[model samples]
Target: MKKVIISLFALVAGTGFAVAEDAGCEAFKWPVTREQALFAAAPATPSGGTLAVGAAADLALVPVDKAAFAVPPEHAPGEGTFGAVASVAVPPEGAIQISLSGEAWIDVIQDGKAVKSAGYSGVKTCPGIRKSVRFKLAAGPATIQFSGAKKAELKVAVLTPE
Candidate 1:
């Protein structure tokens, strides 16, 4: 009986530790500088639309439509699974800055391939916080996709290093 009790306690402790560690934001590397440019503020309509952006137009404001994506039961208010695509043109190889209205999982796709992504266990309880990710991107066309935001409508912005 003593051995069984000890083993059970150890298993439970280990599980708790694992969950804690997995809850962190490890998939996306946060940007060093919070610099970004504000572009357009629009709604991420049901039939998603693509916006043409240049290095000059780094930041964009688009409200997320919660009804567009699947929301899990445990999802917090202002949090839902949503996706928006943006077409960007980079003059030269440089860094891309992406900021979302709330906690979000981001994916950067270029040439039909995913170049970057972010993963988190649960919704980030950031009501007005703008979570951002910066990545090195090649010069050309790239698509930025955002999902798992903590709000029904979110502001999506993009920036390229000057």
Candidate 2:
């Protein structure tokens, strides 16, 4: 019985002897199933884009030089990187979530100042999205800036928390 239980744990743990972790979308620390679903149905948005609540956007980013940010990014991208500046409507609850499909620097700016992140979770092994950051916003318009992305294209989802 002891050996059987140990074998079961190893299999579930993906110890490499029998199974391995695929590290799928379900692996994030917090559930991002909705964001994952949004990515599939999202449409591309240009640099001066507006992402509605509960929707995703395949952000059509540009070279760092042309991102035209309202306030400069905290982490400026070196040559050959990509970025985008977009807006999202914050709900009255003042809590919002932003999810990304790849690695990049995220800045949420409101009222001409950068908004600090309240919570963040990321999973490198997940394929479609890399991180999700939450913020307590002012329940109005907010600017989201992305910089230092390896590619000129990154998928993003902006939504109110569930």
Candidate 3:
């Protein structure tokens, strides 16, 4: 009985590990096209918390805790840029408004290509002025890449029309 129990435990644990491995960030391919990123229809709204990319709502607020993740390659404030990835599911039609509350630039990537980009302009602040970029989005899985001046925290909001 003791041996049988141990074997069962190992099987369960191994299965859990496999599931986790498959869910890792590597599973997502970057720079997908706008069309490729669309969902068949609008998905349900997401609740407040750490922004869940593929499960985010029409309005997703993402917090950039600099201490939480490593900074990506640098770029001029409004020029080229790099940062972390947030998965988002856009509607079949309409536009997504990407806004930043600090010194940061955002790139919307579908199928590993940047479809749209919003850069920062004006004076930088702790909770900086709201800079935004709006573009048409198709329903699907899209990646939002954020890069900006080194700061303790930043807020990013993705808003879609009602």
- How accurate locally is residue 89 in candidate 1, as Cα lDDT from 0 to 100? 66
Candidates by lDDT, descending order: 2, 1, 3
| Candidate with maximal lDDT | 2
Better of 2 and 3 by TM-score: 2
* Best model number under TM-score: 2
The TM-score of predicted model 2 comes to 0.84
Across residues 59-135, which tens digit of lDDT does each residue of candidate 1 receive?
33234553232222222325334444456664475566666556656666666666653322222432333466666
Q: Write the per-residue lDDT of candidate 3 for residues 1-84, one digit (tens) a residue.
A: 999999999999999878756643322222112212332232433222234423222322234432122233234332332234
Task: Show where candidate 3 strays beyond 4 Å.
Answer: 1-82, 117-128
Off by over 4 Å in 2: 1-23
Off by over 4 Å in 1: 1-47, 51-80, 117-127
RMSDs, each prediction? 8.7, 4.1, 17.0
Provide TM-scores for the models. Answer: 0.48, 0.84, 0.45
